[model samples]
Target chain A: MVFGADRECEFLSAPRPSTQETFSGQPLACLEVLGRTMVERTVQQFFQADVEFVTLLAPVALSHSLPSFRERNRALKVKLANDMPLAIGRTLNEYSRNGIDNCFVVSGNLYAETDLLDFFFFHREAMRPVSRAVDHDGPLDMWVVDTAKAMRFDGDQFSKDVNSYLIGGYVRRLDHPADLRGLINDALVGRCAMRPSGREAKPGIWIDSGAGIDRRARIVSPAYIGRGSRVHEDALITRSSSIERNCRIDCGTVIEDSSILANTSVGIWLDLRHAIACGDKLFSLAHGVAVEISDPSLLQPMANVVHAAPARGNLEVIEIEEENLFPLSTQEEAPARPKWQLGANLIQG
Target chain B: MRESSPVIVMEVPTILNDVEGQAFLQETQPLLEGGRPCLVLDCSHLQRVDSAGIEVLLHCMEDAMKRDGDVKLAAVSPACAALLELMRVDRVFEIFQTAQEAVQSFHTPAAIDAPVTLPWYSHPGGLDALKAAS
Candidate 1:
């Protein structure tokens, strides 16, 4: 279960700007990387290692977390919990109630591709209270422990400073969006165990099966656009960017070395470089600036974006081919810009 | 791509805001100084254009019209076109899909779609366009 506050949203700005009333607090766990969340990725690692009966805990309501994430394996379970204390308490209580001996405690906020089976067996054989994976940074907080014995029955506090076993493959504690940036670069360079969607459009670029890309758009090397995303005309996605599922890239925007989270719609005529866009909120991971875009015409949430018909003709196919042909279109015309409200700043960030 | 036909072609950068628009006017002032004012503004690379870009285009268009010539936009991106259309300036310029097509429009004067009915409240010389431009 993912129960840690080391990298939780404690000191960040208000999750929503005042202008938006319908904004829900979407956790970073739902921020899809290569079409998979950190939780989903961690769960997949366990499933791949032939580990059965896994349980997950998250901060958000189960509705927001479980819709798109009906896992491949049936043995996985999910629960709603707020922080590490509650999550740990719930996990141990449930395990104890079920008479389960040892359970794997995986943090939803962390992503590692270690030999999970080996780690479990290592913990089983070590005859210790817990056996956690330790990377160069420190303990990854993912370990196998006798839930009833190690955790307090009252379920309030447990010591995190435990001895760890170094069984490192590709471990990373996603403490910040900046940390995700390194993991993205690692995944792009083929260092990590994550997989891209569909076929590789080129050696480095990966476009999933159902992405919409305008013919006028230019995608440079080492980019990944997930399924059901739309890239509009004259848009430029270059230099190691990742756009997750069902996201929309409006006209004239340039995204370079950025990560656009799922179900988010990026606005027109903007430049995004070395950043992370979660929903309508933009965070310049490079500049440490976070701004909420209230204009729906600009950046907004569209969970139903995948259901809409994508742009057609040349952009119909997920053409991963490196072709920059500007095919002439008679239908081309300058559409109107969104009416700017009196004092609403065009580029807030 | 510079095309030195009877209709001179001037390339526009992707971003054409106030500063860049002013710089563009300065760079092209020499061409408009003494020669025939016929010009084709290539906007193939122009992904964005603000009100200042619109002002420059209209000013150059008026200057060309004063000299009995015209300015046409060629290969304007969807984004540039959208902003122009939103401000109702799309009707003011003779637009083409390609630079070659825009150049060819100079030979056939009947093909030009000059702005006949602009919104009376908004004129390039007036404060509305100026306010909108900023």
Candidate 2:
């Protein structure tokens, strides 16, 4: 069995490597790279090792529930807890009571390809309470813990100076937003085992099901268009770029070496190069700056556009199609003080 | 009447939002309207620039172009440079590493009007050789 921590709020900033919230407010592990999230891919790796049951511990409830994988695995449990140490301790105690000898405790904030079966064998041979996985860089946030012996110990104390298992596999610490883009580029170029979750339509171009690409739109090699996303006419997606799920690339826009996150709408006639665009926020890796675009004509969240309805009465509906209209109708709330209110108070006085 | 300087260098504000963009445009209005104005915008202090700021830059360029003048950028920060490159504004504006370099560039002719040498094929017998080969 595998018990992983998908701590969305507990992100680490690099250079110092201390706990800090991501500037985008989205955790790196939870962000999708090549159509698959890092946490999801980590969970799948454990399942491939013939693990019977898997439990995910998150600080807060996930906005979207993970796939249960009922047919592929025995059971999948997602639990919420504020205290990670206590949660891991309690879970290990439960596992030990159920007669489970050992369990893998993986920090889902990292993408590691360390062979779990090999790690398990190493842990068994060493006869230690825990075995921490290490690479050339140093110890990763992955450990194989002995549930019975570690039942009394918290998650932090369990892995302290434990048996170190050296791994020569791919490992990426998903700490910064730039690392997320790097992961996407690495996966596209075959530097890592992580591949795009879509079918390779051409030599290097991958297109998922339900993606609509106009005939005039050009997708050069090593690019991906995700499911339910639309590429408008004359749009150019090239140079290891990925347009994730349900995104819209408007006409004449060129995406070069960039990752457009899920549920984003890039406006017409724009050139996005070496950047990561999530919703209306665009982070340029080359310039090392993140900008929040206010104009819907340039970039905006797809959620806002998808749910927007035309205003009633002589507002003169700008666009007949719901998708074309700017995402402003829904954003404006009812005025706190109506113009008629002040006039009525004056008349009453 | 005061003689207009051959080249004008203007420093951009740190933050070029909507209000600042309007003020910047108003400041450059005279230089843009002056005949054949060569302006260099110093972007060394520019930290953030929004769409309104971009529009102001474009408007300044448009006015200069109408008056047979040009506007160039100098010492652009990476953030502002990326924003310009994203919007493809870099294609239109000539960017320089320093304001002095941008100012110096105005003195040097970008292109020569007259050809220095004739093509070898332009010789009298060159056409005869071409006709025979054809």
Candidate 3:
């Protein structure tokens, strides 16, 4: 059996950018990839490796807010730090005080699938104060450090003489939107360990729970329809594209090699190719430009939809505004009526 | 030999939405009606464009082709150029840096098929160079 149970190893995750500002130059790690956040996946990795505890260092602004992804480890703690380096240094000093010899210090802004137990054992065998992960590209921010020696760590950067552990597994630096798309495509094609969290309806096609895909909707292979998403009639999703949670792909809209992020509603009969859409903002990957469409009919945030609530007593005749009855959205909240409700309304009207 | 029609340069509006697109189409309708019409849409003032605006551009191009004529774009802003590229309409029109160059293109038969030189940012190494400098 693996020798990680008795070991008092811990994990310290540095502060990561909030996914809400993803298009505004934040790291892609916090953004929901496939069905889970990278932080959740990283925590799960530590939990699976029998790591004792995992602590997440969050920025002061994002201290109160946590991502929606579920963490497998209940021992995961969130600590606020105005300064990352000072926080990391203080945390390392505290760990040393607690008799915790060494801990895994992983960067929050990356998704790496290196064997944690192997890395731990390698660090011990190397007899170095610090061991950093390096791949074919270059050195990563991932490290295993001696808690005492790393007490005075220079922010997140390691000294030039630190030991290097060559990682033979997958690692993705979430620096750019193109890297995000590349990671998604790589995960879908089985180049990495990160798999879509859902049932594979067919070969190369993943459909998450509660996804309402019309029978007429054509979902070509190697595409993902995330949780609670909807794909309307004649909508074509092809070429390694992903319609993330709570998004609505309208009728006859062809999405090829693109990502329709959570809670977005695309207009009908439009062709979205090589793009990433979040609400009304569409970023073209091919052209390297982002535009915000002002027309609600063309594209709008799903949460911006105003619902007609039922009125009590006296029965005041409130006029109901016309809603776009076009089929499907890709996420959770169906505030007023589902697509079937629209069909019922159509019949009644 | 017949003398060619003079190139008509139409100024595009600031915001190219449905209303602006219809007005633009109406303004260029007379030019498209003429035989062998050479049109250049100057987009220096363009800031925003919707899908309908792109549709108007296509409609003008179709009308021009029907009358044995052509439509070219000139002085397209980066934002407009990006949108056109997104809609895959960049390949349909011949784009020029300035309206004068677009106007001169009509008279120069040899320069009609010349490829437009791409901006530095369009090159793969260009982004790396930019990043290095920054």
Ranking by lDDT: 3, 2, 1
Total clashing pairs for each candidate: 4, 0, 12
> Tens digit of lDDT per residue, candidate 3, span B1-92?
34599888999999888999999899899989989889999999999998899999999999999987899999987667766765668889
Model 1 chain A: lowest-lDDT 10 consecutive positions: A6-15
Question: Which residues of candidate 1, in runs, are more than 4 Å off?
Answer: A1-24, A60-67, A82-87, A97-99, A153-157, A303-349, B1-134
User: Would you list the C-alpha lDDT of every candidate in the order shown?
Assistant: 0.62, 0.71, 0.73
Model 2: clashing residue pairs? none
**Whole-model lDDT for model 1 versus the true structure?**
0.62
Please provide, for model 2 over A112-136, each residue's C-alpha lDDT reduced to its tens digit, 9 standing for 90 to 100: 8777777887888898888888899
* TM-score to true structure, per model: 0.57, 0.77, 0.77
Local accuracy of candidate 3 as per-residue lDDT tens digits, A1-349: 2454333556545445654335633345555678776776787788888777777765554433334443223566656666667777877888888877778888766788878888888888899889989999998878888898887668544645688999988889876777778888999888998888776767778877667777667888788888778888888888889988778998888899998876789878777888888788888787677777776766777873222223322212222223322222233335434453222221100
DockQ of each: 0.02, 0.52, 0.20
lDDT of 1 at A96: 66
- Pairing residues by index, what is the TM-score of model 2? 0.77
Off by over 4 Å in 3: A1-21, A24-26, A62-65, A156-159, A304-349, B1-3, B18-33, B55-68, B75-78, B85-134
Instruction: At residue B20, give the lDDT of candidate 2.
Output: 97
